[model samples]
Target: MTTITLVQGDITRQSADAIVNAANSSLLGGGGVDGAIHRRGGPAILEDCRRLRASHYGKGLPTGRAVATTAGNLDARWVIHTVGPRFTREEDRSELLASCYRESLRVADELGARTVAFPAVSAGIYGWPMDDAARIAVETVRATETSVEEVRFVLFDEPAYEAFARQVG
Candidate 1:
């Protein structure tokens, strides 16, 4: 069985095959997890994003989609960048939030990654509630089909850890 684990720490420090970035559509880098990944992962990741922007994703990566780039200075071999939709009351965008996890795993599978780490995605600056974010993350990863042997949710704090723990338990 594919194991799902939760860790409370910096996602950038995890030594998995790939780490999912809760990126903005620009993918050039933004606040929260995106900024941390790009900053710690170094210029190589940004260079790749620039190339991606210059080449294919000029309009920027659409929300709910994912693309991979080199991990740069991080322990992981790859960084899977996915844009998470901002939470809104006008429409239900829960599916898009779930897609971040699904698409990241797809990218990881393409890279033959056996283990991957993910953040809380929209739960941060995008304002998706932590409980709902945890629910979608866990449920989507549990239901998705992939070759990844381990999926770790590398949360940054105690509340995030407890939220994911409730879902995992």
Candidate 2:
């Protein structure tokens, strides 16, 4: 069983075996956690992303899907990039959001990663409600089976931390 932990801090600063980046479909680089990871992890991450784009991810990474890249300057050995679905009331995309966490773990497992740090996924500019996002993340991670020993949801703010805490508790 994996132990879930919540921390109120920057995901980019977390030292784990892998860090999950809530990336856009392009997977090249975008705002929020994506930008932060690329900025701090240096050009190596973007170079890997570009290579992915040119090879396997020609159409860009699909929503809810995940891929791994070198961590570069970050403390982690690898960075797992997963794209979260945009929030839209017209359609129920909760499963897609959930898949972001699930797929990240799958990739982490393949890489023999024991600890993973994740951001709030779709809760940022994607417009997912923070509370609901927390619920999906916690529930999905708890339900999924993997070799990962610890999962850390690293939040950038107090409200986000509290929301995840409620779900974790």
Candidate 3:
């Protein structure tokens, strides 16, 4: 059984075997957690992302899918980039949102990452409600089977942290 933990801090600073980035499809980098990881993780991270863009992800990564790259300057061996779905009331894309966590864990298992730090996928600029995002993330991680010994949700703010805490509790 994996132990779920919550931390109200920057995901970039977490020292885990893998850090999950809530990246956009572009994967080049954007605002929020994606930009933070790219900036702190340094050029090597971007270099790997560029290589991935040139080869496997020419048109950008699809939503709900995930891939890994060098952690660069961050305190981790690998960075798992997962694109989250944009929330909308017209359609239910919760499955895709849940996939972000599931796929990231899948990649972490592949990298032999026993400890992983994750951000709230789509809860930031992507407009997914903080509560729903927290619920989905916690529930998915609880349900998924992986080799990870610890899964830490590194939230960036009090609200995000509280939301995840509610679900975690």
List the candidates' TM-scores in order.
Answer: 0.98, 0.99, 0.99
lDDT, candidate 1, residue 16? 95
Off by over 4 Å in 1: none
Q: How many collisions per candidate?
A: 0, 0, 0
Off by over 4 Å in 2: none
TM-score of 1: 0.98
Better of 1 and 3 by lDDT: 3
Instruction: Please provide, for model 2 over 54-144, each residue's C-alpha lDDT reduced to its tens digit, 9 standing for 90 to 100.
Output: 9999999999999999999999999999999999999999999999999999999999999999999999999999999999999999999
Displacement of residue 22 (Cα, Å) in model 2 is 0.4
Error in Å for residue 117 of model 1: 0.5
State the lDDT at 91 in candidate 3: 98
What tens digits encode model 3's per-residue C-alpha lDDT throughout 20-127? 999999999999999999999999999999999999999999999999999999999999999999999999999999999999999999999999999999999999
lDDT preference between candidates 2 and 3, better one: 3
The C-alpha local distance difference test score for the whole of candidate 2 amounts to 0.96
Residue 54 Cα positional deviation in candidate 3, in Å, after optimal superposition? 0.8
